[model samples]
Target: MKKFSLLSNRAGALFLAPGAILVALFVIIPFFWVIFVSFTNRTLLGRTAVNPDFVGLQNYLALFNPETFFTRGQFGFSLILTTQFVILSALVGQALLGLLLAWLMQAVPKPLKAFTETCVIAAWILPEVVIGFAWFAFLDYDNGTLNGILRSIGLPGADLLLQQPFWVIVFFNTWRGAAFSMMLFNSAFQSIPPSYFQAADVAGATSFQKFRDIALPLIRGHVVTDLILITMWTFNVFTPFILTHGGPSYRTELLSIYTYRVAFKDFEFGKGAAVGVIIMLINLAFALVYLRIARSRNKEAEQ
Candidate 1:
């Protein structure tokens, strides 16, 4: 029995070793390295050149200075804009729409459900660059499909890309990403027993009431998981860089774009690392909030 157990333990470690090594190599090591780099005055060129000196929190201080952060077209504004984009596009747009689609799918016929699932999955699996280019063409000013439709209907077509760049990107991200959330919710909903819904119907509960009282409570865990995943993904997304290029005077320049500009474009490696640290902290904050909410929901469900 001892010999057999030893072999089983060795087999389990073999399966787990690959994933553990990859995480340490990619996620864990890089996370601390970025933090270490943030405290040094690193530069790709000029006097600092090859060797970087320790500057403590100078990079952070400079980044958060009154003029730098508060200025209309600066780091502070970029952070604020990115927050808005994540909240609206990921939290509200994708989460709400995906949940609705999942609920709607429950009542859809099998044929329609399969077709819709295929379409949604197709969108989800397509390359991010392809989605960006597709949206770019769809929203182009003059000869785009959207403008063509507007002109056919005797309406004046405006340059949505230039006029509403931020919202356009938000909508674009939501459309491309909602399919994941929808599939997640669908899976969660499937695990729910139908007896609860039947009981609610027998009690003469309305659809909204049933959803609020039954589905919401049961799917709380999945909702929390889906939101955290989408929020992080949306916050860090660089796909819109292909579409908007963070252009139109930096109006849609998210924090990730801002970090890229400061680090690579400006050759200020230290400041960029500081920005990277800040974004990491922000993501950490989101994860904490999600975990707290999930914990509370779990406690309530247990009671």
Candidate 2:
């Protein structure tokens, strides 16, 4: 029996070895490499590219420099913009809209519920390029679907992308990400026993009352999970680049787009790597919070 157990353990290790090696080569190595590069004054089209010097903390210091901190196209500006984007699009828009939709779906007819889910999920699953282009065309001021409709209704068309790029991306991200939150909340609501809601109904509880009291309490864990996940996802989202190109005046430049422009466009590899490290740290914090919440929830469940 001991011999068979040893053989089984060896087989399991063998099965995992390839994947472990791949992760080390790809994920782990690159992670530390980025950290190392951030300490240098590296650029793609410069002498530094050939012989990058370790200018420790200069890249990070430049990002936080007080003179340029609040200026447009600077790291601080992008960080603030990304924070606002995450708050409006993820925490407020996606979480609230998704929760409402999930709650409403609970009382809707089966076919309507299914159709609504399909439509929302379609928005979530569609190719990012296709969705971005479609939205761009729809919102275009001239020869666009939305403009045409507005013109038909005797209303003037507006240049949403150029005029209100930040809001445009906020709305775009909200629409794009709401489906995931909705599905998560829907599952959370499902895990709840129907009898609880039925009891509330017998006690003359209104829909709002039941939702506020019973449903909300029961799904607190899911709500936290959804908020954290969506916040991180929105923070790192680059799809807004397609719609607004972080442009017209850098109005919609989230951290992700700012990083791309810095690293690839400006060819400031070191500064970009610094930005990437900061982003990774922010994401790490979010991940840690999520894990802690999950562990607490698991403990509560076990209790």
Per-candidate count of clashing residue pairs (backbone under 3 Å): 0, 0
User: Candidate 2 on 1-303: residue-level lDDT in tens?
Assistant: 445464587888988999999999999999999999999999998689999999999999999999999999999999999998999999999999999999999999999999999999999999999999999999988878998998999999888888888899999989989999999999999999999999998999999999999999989989999989998889889999998889878888889999999999999999999999999999999999999999999999899
Q: Which is the leading candidate under TM-score?
A: 2
The lDDT values for all models are 0.90, 0.94
Candidate 1 — what's its lDDT? Answer: 0.90
Candidate 2 stretches greater than 4 Å from native: 1-7
Cand. 1 TM to true fold: 0.87
- lDDT, candidate 1, 1-303, per-residue tens: 445464587888988999999999999999998899899988899777578999999999988998678665588999889989999999999999999999889879999999999998888999998888888888888778899899999999989889899999899889889999999999988999999999999999988888899998999889989999999999999988887878888988988988888889988888899999999898899889888988888898799
Regions of model 1 farther than 4 Å from truth:
1-22, 289-303
TM-score per candidate, in order? 0.87, 0.96
| Window of ten residues with lowest summed lDDT in model 2 | 1-10
